[model samples]
Target chain A: MLAIETKQLSKSFWKNKVVDNIDLQVEKGEILGFLGRNGAGKSTFINMLTGIIQPSSGSYALLGVQGPNDSIKKKIGVMPDYSSLYGSMTAINHLHYLADVSGKPVSRQHCMEVLKLVGLEEHANKKAGKFSFGMKKKLAIAQAIIHDPQLIFLDEPTSGLDAESVIHIHLLIQQLHQQGKTIFMTSHNLDEVEKICSRIAIMKDGRIKKSGTMDELRAYYQSTITVTIKHSPIRPADLSTMQQWLEQAGTQLDIKENHFTIQVESEQKIAEIIRALGTYKIDIYRVDVEEPSLEEIFLEE
Target chain B: MLAICKREFIQSFKGIKSIIIIAIFLLTAYYSADFSDLLLSLSDDFTSEEKQIIHTVGISFLIMFLGMLFVMGLSHDIVNREMHERTIRFLVTRTSRTSIIVGKFLGIALFWFVCLLTSFVIISIFVHRFDLITLFQSASLAIYYSAFTVLLSVLIPKPSITMFLSIVIGIAFPILNGWVSLTSNVWVSWLKYLFPFYYVEEQNYSFLVVLLLAGVMVGIALLVFRRREC
Candidate 1:
């Protein structure tokens, strides 16, 4: 079954539409990265799916159940970006309370184990209010997965963390991913998303502007293939012949000394250009193909 | 639901506000019994039933004033606190929003019940004999006041503002109710229903009034809260 499915889901505040006609589906066991700029309705969409806010229009299904089913809620976990922990409660106390409410009660020992998983074992007795921002964030993550949910929604799971904490959270996310848990995460950190997410959906103006795998997005947003070529000492005659051959093939070429940078039409053109250069007796040393990064694709109009 | 109740119940005792309120309640019970004893010692013709009624009224007065304040303090932030802290997201994702409201109301009601029982223990120390109906009234009154406070907490975003408004309406409305009696207009007398004092004074019908009021407050709160966005 699909982990999450939404049909033209939308949310509005007065006349302002925050989530507009977003149809999204997340398959089981895949990390689906949700990316959007500020005010792009990323949180609103998560809120609707998690039952925190009702959609003004459209409907959604979670784990095959329709519309915020209690049975489905028990199967899903959420790490909200803006959620705060109880100040006076210890980490274990917070976990126990959340676990019980989620219908998955745990002992203090179990709570400690979960805290330890989040690197909060030593601070188990400290009140949440006294915890540092990064520590509280870790606790929020621990609470989200306390129930061992089938599908987990993590909103900026590693946001506002030190490098070590980020690495720890990344490892935890990888561990969860390896355990066959489907994760839907939203983050502004493009590099992290590129590393952890299997596929991504980019939202703009309350609509999904693009959604695909890394290769698909890169290809969709980019058309030219940039090939940098290094050749052995080429005489001026050979250089002129290579330039003429590249121009005839309709490739954009730049030459400086023995280095030739060619922007070709497609992947097929790279092989064609290399063969043409070889035919010209231009000895080739090395070749490199440059593909666009996810960030560049995301920032494209 | 029980889990939410248990956490809130424990948290109530962890703070000094709850302890201070309960201590003052015990003191009020003591004073009520003492005043009743002084009046009874001076009067010779008063029957046991009449004496019981006098003690009930005196204690009810203390509860009507101070008990409402305690209820206000106990429940004024139940819903808004979660919203303000942005912690409602965690609970709402795991449980139904209706469960959240119901669980919190139950938790606050339980806390108020404990306070009432403690008050009964204190009242028994001096009066030796207390009215069972009065005990029931106090419990119902506690529930009634808590329901309104819960409703106000859901309607208002700010806990401090909710408490301020609750105190004004809870304390001032009754005082204004006295002025309403000077005019014999039917509508003016109808305003007495707005205050808990009217129902607290009812000897035979207070039980029904308190329950019905609690039902209305909770029903409205649930409806409004269910429609509210996180």
Candidate 2:
């Protein structure tokens, strides 16, 4: 079953629409990264899905449940876009209370295990009021998954964190994914999303502008493929043959010392040039195909 | 619902509000019992049941005069505080909004029950007998205030605004109630019907109306809270 589905979902404040008419779906056991700039309606969309706020129009379903009823709530977890922790509560107490309230009470030992999963085992007894920003973020994640929810919504899980904390969070997310849990996360860090998300959706001005796998996006926006080849020095006869083949593709190769960088229309032309070079009896050292980064695709629009 | 209720109830006792409210309640119970005792000493024909009734009425008078104010003061920000802190966002996703309102009401009502029971224990120390029905009435009166506090917290969108209105109503309600009996105007006298003094007589049935009012307020609060955006 689909983990999350929305059809023509929209939310408007007064005259301004925050989440425009949008259709989106996330499959079970997939980590879908929601990407957008600031004020891009990412959080608002999540708020509607999690029942924090009702949608202005349209409808949604979570795990085959049409509404945010008890079954749906018990099946999913969320870390909201704001500070959702109680200041006076300890990390363990927060988990314990939330678990009980969700009607899926876990053991204290299990709560400790969840704390350990997020690298917060040492601070289990520490009050959340005294935690650092990174620690608070970790605690927030722990609470979201404490009930063993099948679908988890993490809003900016690692927006502001040290490199170490970011890595820790990334690993925890991956671990959760490994357990067959569907994760829907929103992040401003494009590189992190690129590194972690199995699928991605980009939002802009309250609408989804682009969404696909990295390779799919790269292939769509990538107009020219740049190939770098390191080979033996070439003779004039071999050079002319290479030049003729490169010119046929409307681009020429850049030769510096022992390496050549050439732009071609597709991967087929790269294979043709490699075969041509081999026919000339040149020792081919290496060939590299540069795929566009998520940053590049995100900024292209 | 029970889980949220348990948390709220436990949290109430963690700070000084419980201690302070209980201490003052014990003192009030002591004074009320002492005054009733002095009156009893002046008379010899009154039966034991009559003595218990007098002592209960004396204690109930002070409790009724201050119960609404105490509950409103303690619980004025109950819902709005969660909204202000954004913790309600976490709760809304885990449970239904109706349960949150009802859970909070149960918590506050339970706290009031404990406070009333303690004061009754103090009053019993002097009278040599416990008044179970009076404790029930005082506890129900406090629960009535608790219901209104929940409604106010849900109706006002901001914590500051709710707190302000709770204080205004808490102070004003008792004062107006004091004048409700003395005034000759029909409009002013109508409010006495809302007062516990108008209902808590041995044979009066109007006390049930207070409970019915509490039920209606809670029902309205549940409806309002469900539509609120966390």
Candidate 3:
């Protein structure tokens, strides 16, 4: 079953579309990366889904419960981009207060566990006002997941963290995924999305430009193979000779300086290129082929 | 809701505005000794017929100052400080919006009740030579006036606005009431009844009016907060 689903959801502020018509779905326990550049309606979409703001049109459901349902709210968690903690309260006080309001039977030990998970155990008794930005972010994370919510919406979770903290947050997210928690996180960090997300949707101008698993997206958009040859300086005319041979063998070529970059329809043509280059007594230095990154695909779209 | 109420009550002092209000109240109250002789000398000019009026007006000034403090502390804690700190989002997520608004209103009201009761106790000790009956009457009146002022605090968005309106009503209504009493003008007399200060003059009927007004204000605050966007 899908943990979250939206159909034709749209949101506007003062008749200006902040989030245009959008359709989205995330299955149970799936880590779906919501990728977009800044102001690409990523945060706006998440805000609507979490009921932080009402949508201008369309409908959505959380765990089969429709929008604005109180029961659905209990099953979902949200960590907004900003820290919304009371500055005067100690970290433990904030968590305890939230636990009480959530009506969850959380104990002191559970609070400590959450603090330890976020590596804020030592600072649990310190006022949140004195906490660093990263610590406050961790506190926000702890508050979101304290109730062990089934679905979590995390917006730019790793944006302001140090490298180590980012890795820790990624590990925490992975642990939650292992515990069968559905995570819908929005981020502009393509590398982090590539490492953590099971599937991804690339958004641009308030719409999903493309979406698929990494392998499926790669297969669909990356049909060309690029090879770099480094032996000696070769003229474009000389490279065109190689291009003609590869074209006859059913491939394309782009040459620059001493490098011969060839686009092949299939891996079977690699052997043909080697055989054709063997006839010219040209030294084949190196061959490198890579699928396009999500960044490249997003830019191309 | 109880958890949120407790949080708001305790967090009240954490706001800079609350601290400044408490500081100003304590400082002004303590230092008012400088003017006590002047106030006592003015009391000598009152005839037996006007003694009650003079005492009521003197107590009203003290209460008004305290009301200003209450308004500053409560209004900032409820509206301005919460928005400034950006903690309302976290609060709304954990508790319902109704719970937040109602809890804050009640919590600040409770804070004012405690502070007013304490201040009245001190005043009674100094003025009545530790007479228990005098202490009770003074404290009861303080509580009644505090409730009225706290209600005003809840309705107005700013402390200065509440204080300004309270002062205007407090000073103008009594003069109008006196003029109506002398001239026997029904319209002006009826207008005086609309002001909260009219109810503060006599202890018997005024207490009931104060209570009813507090209840009505609280209900309006809750209803307004229920449908509030954030």
Residue A257, model 2, lDDT:
69
List the TM-score for candidate 1's chain B: 0.86
Using TM-score as the measure, which candidate wins? 1
Error of 1 at B8 (Å): 2.3
Candidate 3, superposed: residue stretches over 4 Å from native: A223-242, A245-252, A255-259, A264-287, B13-65, B116-195, B198-230
The DockQ values of the predictions, listed in order, are 0.85, 0.72, 0.30
Minimum summed lDDT over a 10-residue window in model 3 chain B is located at B129-138
Better of 2 and 3 by TM-score: 2
TM-score-based ranking = 1, 2, 3
- Lowest lDDT 10-residue stretch of candidate 1 chain A: A242-251
Tell me each candidate's TM-score: 0.94, 0.90, 0.75
Per-residue lDDT, model 3, residue A26, is: 86
The local lDDT score (0 to 100) that residue B220 gets in candidate 2 is 96
RMSD of 1: 2.2
lDDT of 1 by residue, A117-139 (tens): 99999999999999999999999
lDDT of all predictions, in order shown? 0.83, 0.85, 0.68
Model 2: share of true interface contacts reproduced: 0.86
